[model samples]
Target: MTKNNLVFETLPLYNKQSLEELLKNRINQLGDFSFEDDKWYYSKKNDNPLRKEDFIVNFYQVPIQYKNELKYYALLSTGLPRVIRTKCNKISQFLKFIDKTYLELTIAEITRSHVNAYEYQLRLKNSATYVKQGYYAAIQDFFMKLTDFDDTPNTVPTKNINPFRYIKEKSKRKPIPKKVIRSWDRVMKDQDIPIPLEFRTFYWLIRSFPNRISELLSMRRDCLKSFYSEYLIQIPTTKQSGGFIQEEIKTIPVAYSGHGKYVINLIQQLQEQTEELLLKNNIEEDIRTDFLFIVQQWGFKNNGDKPSVRYYDQIFHLKKHKINALFKQLAEILDFRDDLNQLIIPTSHQFRHNAVTDRAYAVGYTMEQIRRLTGHKNEVMPKHYTHQLIEKHKEIHLGIENLRSSNVSPVEFRGKIMNLDERTTKQLSRDPRRYLTWEANGKKGVGICSDITGCNPKGTSVHFECYACDWFVPKLEYLKDYKAEYEYWMDVVDRTSGDTKRAAHFENAIRNVSYLERILKICKNGIEHFKEEKLQEQLDKFNTPPVWE
Candidate 1:
């Protein structure tokens, strides 16, 4: 089949406005478009920054086969110009590693092996785990676009398409333990650093408040509002989860606390500094938005003058690099442990996790409560790894029902606990060497890093297989170990079956307690509510609880 010329009138439906605009602006400077055997041609001096360096777009209107692939790359590059630029560069690097550029590549030409090679190259460059996965996944989507177009006659090889499935990256999230919080508190309170107090406050807010970094960076001054009986700051749609946006304003609510208060104080300090600095240079309306931060150039004597809000077009990327550099410098001065490097690296999303974890401890909030605060619609936590970790712990502590149940005295429970303790100790002693090296003191002193035995090479997950590993063995052992606790859980389960109050107690215990003692405390606290069943049965105390006579 002979390829048709891609003229102004013949462009695809999705290509309408952009092609129309480009054609109008360039028709005079450029000539008619034409197609030759297996190739396409168009000539126009480029003005779009992305195309400016290339000067000309060569190749036939991307073959119908490659059009969708192009659009997929285009969709993934959706943020700011800088974001697109960075993403494009990353894509281009993959293309080069594969030895094909936009014109030279076809959907069918891409393959899983090619992706694997690119991944290997990326690993050699020491690309971070996420970066490697992101770039390759993007490339896969680029190939996917080939399937979406209106004119394509055939599909890319299905087998070669989704390289990410073969090379999924493992979870990189490091759970911040209490000690990390202590270190952050110590440094922030030192008050002797050369860093501006405002910057320090920004750092504190992110660490304390459940906010994505981009949301924090894009915070406009007006988003601040009174919430939960105190003033709270809202972070609108940022780059990560697309902060809740209203009227073109992306935002999330941050309630008042030691951290939230610090954030508010820092905003006032920066606003004053920005206003004074701008006014000194004769900049106008320094008060347009209530943004807590704005981009300014670092000229010989840079003015704090606002760049027409258009500057915010590149806000996400610019702010990310800015914040990353800031923390990196701080990491240097504090002689911060290299171990914390992964945690401290500027990421807007991690702050949201920190808030969830910190609040889960402080307020004893359930996952659902924390989820509501973080704006997660479903029960998914800030990161999958975290959710999985919590689920693992939940399985251990909350698996009381799975144990065999029969009438057993508390003494039997105590005896079983002692026996289990002895068995675990004996097992550990048998493999003491396996546990010793993994227990070295970290910055947090005998840190959770001791659990690093669980760590694996991130990227390319291994499917969980019971047939391959006996994960169920421990669950079985628990059933045999604590017969009394198991019976108690069964009782709770039966009591709560038709009773909402009892069900809530079980859920509360799962969310709030990790240790056996803590579990008892939570259950005890809810005992009053559970005991009121008879009172509830007497009559509906709709208004006032008819004087507890």
Candidate 2:
């Protein structure tokens, strides 16, 4: 065949759909292709030609040596169908580039300059930097595999000569802002606006649960599992691990606070609706298990049987672009605008970021705890979410330092104060001057006591609780420590929301700080400086809780 005819026959000319079908058919017919029991097998196909068209028909086919290498690499390497398809496309593109540019050049004869030229062409064709980088990496991986292939007969060793190894990949997406998240939540929950129930529930789950959009869409009726009184959803992870496409499960607990109830109710309702629909359609027992989320759409089919079912599959299952478009449409409908009045478009991944960040800061979850909730194997991603929290904590710490600069004299203590240490207690027992006279059990006894004893149970040891104890006195040196303690508690109160045990603890600490402040004011002013009622009123005003929402 002529060079032009060879190029037309060997090169991939079809669209994505046609290419996928062609490759699938080729792999199934010529290779050991088996997908039984939901498991894929390509072991025997590793050494076989992937397609007869290139091996038999095309004159300028991918050199048999490189073709076989690529076939084995594609089969042996584990990735999702989409990912594998992308890899095949990248390899085909690289091979075509070589065949067109240097017709006589063998795979071994290709060098860094030739690879660089291919990348340059890719850059011209694909405007996205990340896309260019991805294509380059895939091509590099192809060459690397050729070098590792020990059973190579006519292939060249190109593992050590990877040209695209130094190329950098830049992130084109940014994490969603907290303001947008709050606004989106508020708008979705607004009953007057009348948003779709499914969309509301979908976004609610994304906000409340740290789950990927895909995981949420893939949820089944049996996903929910009860543990004690709490509920957990077993999610099948879509990420790849090791060299094989091994499936993994991530269990996410159903939160009892915030909008957790709303999420649970929605999932339960969806599950029930799916079951009812299946029964009504008289679906077979084997095909009755349906995805949790569904919607009415044209051209919908069931179990490869007939185009009868209108709502068979999950609404957003594997439809990431559509899901993102829906979010944008929701934003438009809600009139979501940033401070500058520009349209605010939200992405599905943003919900994941918002969930992780909210848990890290507002919920006061530790990094490890956030990681567990987010299904992250390490602290890196959790840290990224908590970076803003860390900055806020630093500001709070600085505020504490500024608040602790007050100068005050130490309150005079008539009786020696005993430390909690055993040695100090022995010394207090030995010294009569350290004891305060008290009448107990019809006998005049020497013991620790003060005019005010309303703070704690009698005879109980006072430690850090001194801030709330009326008998305890403050000193100039300890004033800074008191301010620091007060500021820390206030910061915690500001970050925490809803009715949680930690929020309650922070409120209690704030109350103690108010008590300490009252005492300090009294010490600054002499006795009878102000009316008792007026002082009490002022203390009440100071202790009023600040509204967070």
Candidate 3:
């Protein structure tokens, strides 16, 4: 009767063969029908067979109604092969779940209830929080694409349908402890363990430079540039924007000294070895020009007539999982353990975290400075990496408070035992300068003046030369504040950029803080004997009072 009715009438009778043909025709139209030539090609004897057919089959098994939807999605994601493959797998899994549960694979059958059920099932299977969240997001993206497609009939509403809409995924990755890093470094340097050259170089490079694994693995031969005696490396960061993989190149200095090993030298050696291997195997000109890192494959042959010639066609590159596994293997070999004797397996990302955290705490690098090294788009990420350091600093603050309370004694001025009254104690608590008392003629006294000129005499913004002045008196009760100020000024000096005047100011402040801290420590250590002598001297001063001024 009608065109829509006619299509709906024949939809139930469609079989698998016709569906396969339809998918094939659609894929051919999209210019992806190279199944025969695109199949796995083994360049060497031990190379793993490519499994493209399995992906192809998964793509075809997607319902006929959703075929064009997948194509549209592919068009939107043009060059990301890895993303396309992963999304396709996620969609295929959802389709299969629908087929087994509802006896139909059409997208129209998907509803909010079905999504909730799927999520519940995933949780029941003990899937990771991120895994469940990723699947939910992928499915939501798929349905959103289908809703926007021109040819597809509206089966399910895309808006406000995500089952995990409010769910948040906490990152499970933790920073590796500094002790573990030291242990790993020690194990790598030990000659008896037979560590691979590439692994050792990679560990140092990643730890020192803070580059991502992908950036390091994809480095080219010409990435390094020399400026006189110093070398700099241009690292391309692709994941900063969180969208399409776009390269944002960042230049980092190659340290020649204080790094224990020469990074630039090791890189040059690796490049030379790669070139020699490429020449020996006669690799293709394009590959030789493109890639830098390459490994020679070695294994036993049946005849054993000298090991098979190393081939450039089968160049080896370490994947993310492989790098992680290698770290785990190294951890096991080194017998690295935590305080509880739990084995500590470090991840590749931990090196980047360690680099950021250690720089933030130990080297006093500012967030902006760390951003330059880490290729972070903003200060937020660098601050997040330093969360542990912030916590540690808080603990130090608590310890400082305890140290001040336990160390400081009561005040003694000149030859008089200054008794603590509520008002005087409140004044001292409000401003530490209240403890400084100047006696003009042994009886007439004035309180809290670093100089004879009194406070803020010069109308300056800061207290100039107060801590270093001879008339200045630092109460041991405020020693913690002075120590904290000292640390802050030191950090300021370290982070000051190219401004000699400002750096000098911070350095001077640090010196003053240090002087005050040393004085307070000396007074605190001998407060008991000083208090007894002051009490005896006060009795003598009372017996011989000075004339009134």
Total colliding residue pairs, candidate 2: 0
* TM-score for each model: 0.39, 0.45, 0.45
- For all candidates in order, the CA lDDT equals 0.40, 0.47, 0.49
Q: Model 3 — TM-score against the truth?
A: 0.45
Give the lowest summed-lDDT range of ten residues in model 3: 452-461
lDDT by residue (tens digit), candidate 3, 396-415: 32232232232433333442
Q: lDDT tens digits, residues 1-549, model 1? A: 111111112225655445334334433333244322222122232213333433333322334444333433433232333343455455555655544433455444565455566666666776556676677665644443323233432333223433333455689876555555567567666665344554566677666555456556666655566645335354554233211112123222333444445556676677676555544543334223345564343211112321111122222112555676655555444443435554444344555566655543222234454455668876544555344434543444333223221111011121121212443443333222222211111211111111111211110002111111111111112222223443454455334322222334333333323323232332333333334654786556565565874
lDDT of 2 by residue, 1-549 (tens): 111112112212343234334334545642354321122334332312333222221112345435645565564444544455567667777887887888867665777677668867876783566676667778756654333223321222233333334456686656566677678767767776545445566787777655678667666677777654346666655442222233345455444433454566766776776667556654433232456655433231232321122333433222456578767655665555767777778888877766654543232334444466568886444445545433443333223223222123113223323223443333233322213333222323322323221112111112223333333334332344445655665565455422233332333333444544543553444222324546999999889887872
Please report the TM-score between candidate 2 and the true structure.
Answer: 0.45
Q: Candidate 1 or 2, higher TM-score?
A: 2
> Who is ahead in lDDT, 1 or 2?
2
Ranking by TM-score: 2, 3, 1
Which candidate model has the greater TM-score, 1 or 3?
3
Steric collisions counted per model = 22, 0, 0
Give candidate 2 misplaced runs (Cα > 4 Å): 1-61, 82-140, 143-150, 153-156, 159-169, 172-180, 190-196, 240-246, 255-258, 281-289, 297-318, 360-549
Ordering by lDDT: 3, 2, 1
